[model samples]
Target: MEQEANKKRKIIHIDMDAFYASVEQRDHPEYRGKPVIVGGSPNSRGVVATASYEARKFGVRSAMSSRRAVQLCPDGIFVYPRFDVYKDVSRHIREIFSRYTDLIEPLSLDEAYLDVSVDKQGIGSAIEIARLIKQAIKDELRLTASAGVSINKFVAKIASDMNKPDGLTFIGPSQITGFMEQLPVEKFHGVGKVTAEKMKKMGLHTGADLKRLSENEIKQYFGKPGAFYYRIVRGIDEREVQPHRETKSAGAEDTFPVDLTEIETLNKELERIGALVATRLKRHNLKGRTITLKIKYSDFKQITRNQSLPFATDDLEVIVKTAQQLLAAVDHEEKAIRLLGISLSNFGEVIAIHGNSTQLSLFD
Candidate 1:
């Protein structure tokens, strides 16, 4: 039953292999094939953001303390992150991806999904497009990427990682069942630490074992996420290759030097943030349907109030007024506020009220 549906799905997941570490090697030819670490200094309270495979062989991993990594690989070259350069590289890569398909969903600065059903390069076969994209990235940016070609996002994502550094793996329709049978349940998306442990206890350690449980049984064990596990294990995924959506909400946050006990001081700060938000709205030509006020206390507890207006408005006065009213309705009581932030959103839809202000979305 499921085999028929698997034949119809086409999805591609692209990931930059050791993105940050590889970038460091690309710029400096001397670092190629040598251990390279990109993150904080070993002296400071720094963490290892990424390490090259050479460094990995020495047991250096991301989020590991630089001190520990240094102890593991005494010769590892540590370098700070160049986010600006990485962002430029990201833009160049995305530009290459856009040439292939509009159904590009960027996962991060260096990874994305390209649905090549209607490829712009006019290559009907997705595998061909994947080859072209990898060549383009290598030729243009001098970087390596791994791609997973399959019938759905889950399988495609895992397939991409099958080969490391510069890799291209395809999971054809014919390979679906056997692939799932061998796939570890812990590796199934959304089944992380806690779920994996629970699944092991439930005698469901592999996708094949998961396939034995009914949807209701799975849901009974895993609650909300179990249904997803059941469907994905059967080679079923209905998700589209979502495009790079726009930033729906805009807001700013600030932490106070001292907690505020008085309402006037808090309101004053809110007024400033509101004015800033109003100017931003005018700049972007966007109106928000929901005005949200977020407040944090000294005790580390926080709360937010969201008031939905009849229609979205870009008016500064409206945003400020609504924010103030919402703040009043919350539990300010005698509690002191340590942090505050203001946000506005219409779920990515920018309501353009005036003609002069040209509104644009990130998708554009």
Candidate 2:
């Protein structure tokens, strides 16, 4: 019974190397080990979505303007993204993951987490399983991937990124604190740009420095996020790996390919944004009680217009209609439009059981 209870829980994070470009190179044998860029067309005011290591050496990167990428490396090969093909490959990967455990939570097509505490294969060791998974991808897909094995998702994610392109790393529970001590504050999960800057300003540059501060002290300055920071600094995270629900608020905003001064262009852009919000809500089966319209002007100034609703419904029509009204209320003259977005929040889960509440609105 002691041995049964002592069975170590294992989790692995797998990240496909330069996923889009790698997929492209796989389908075309001639492109192997060569620089490849996958995204929109350069002629269509496109940007590089993913660049293989070869293209990366040439200064190509994701979200960089294709025009600039071409200037950076004229010899770089550019190919459009094939989402269908990527999805098919992803399906193959998920099949392999299912052989491990059902507690798989996919972050994206290229990354996912596997919980092996109750693995189907009875592979008692997580590291060995991770190594085998990596090998399987190489053999079956003719592609290289990397993995990180740890007890938790956050550290597992960090480990996977420690080494790239067919690399693997592990962090045992006893080594967690030391692993964090060497970790830079910027590398902490959930600590993004704004927080990193504040930490630096406070002279808290590394996990070791952050560990020196008490939770209360950090909370005194950063409020709720400060509390989160304190826990992560000490290499203590209570959050569990959740499955079946991609729990969190989500929204999409796009910076225009170019600035638009015309009201016609602006109106069209708003409609495009409205359509996007509708699609996401439909996919998540979540209805939100709040709608936010974010705008950025050519001068770099930004504004957000928000509306709260009496009820939450995952109805695209409702969100789109609210977004349209919000757009009509904004001032779009004099300055050109740089970006537009629509966000829906005050999210609540959808329950098919009639015993459950419909249009839940606890936050509202």
- Listed in order, each prediction's TM-score against the native is 0.68, 0.73
TM-score of 1: 0.68
Report the Cα lDDT for residue 19, model 2.
88
Off by over 4 Å in 1: 1-6, 246-364
lDDT by residue for model 1 (1-364), tens: 5556556656789999888899999999999999999766777544566799999999998656677889999999998766557767888999999888889987667778888877776788888888889999999999989999988888899999889879999989889889988898878877776578888998988999999999999999888898888888888887777785665786766777789878788887776566556545543446778889999998868999998888877555677678878888887667889988788887436443334232211101
Model 1's alpha-carbon lDDT is: 0.78
* lDDT scores in order: 0.78, 0.75
RMSD per candidate (Å) reads 9.9, 8.6
Clashes of each: 0, 0
Q: In model 1, how large is the Cα lDDT of residue 306?
A: 90
For model 2, where is the 10-residue window of minimal lDDT?
Answer: 355-364
lDDT of 1 at 133: 90
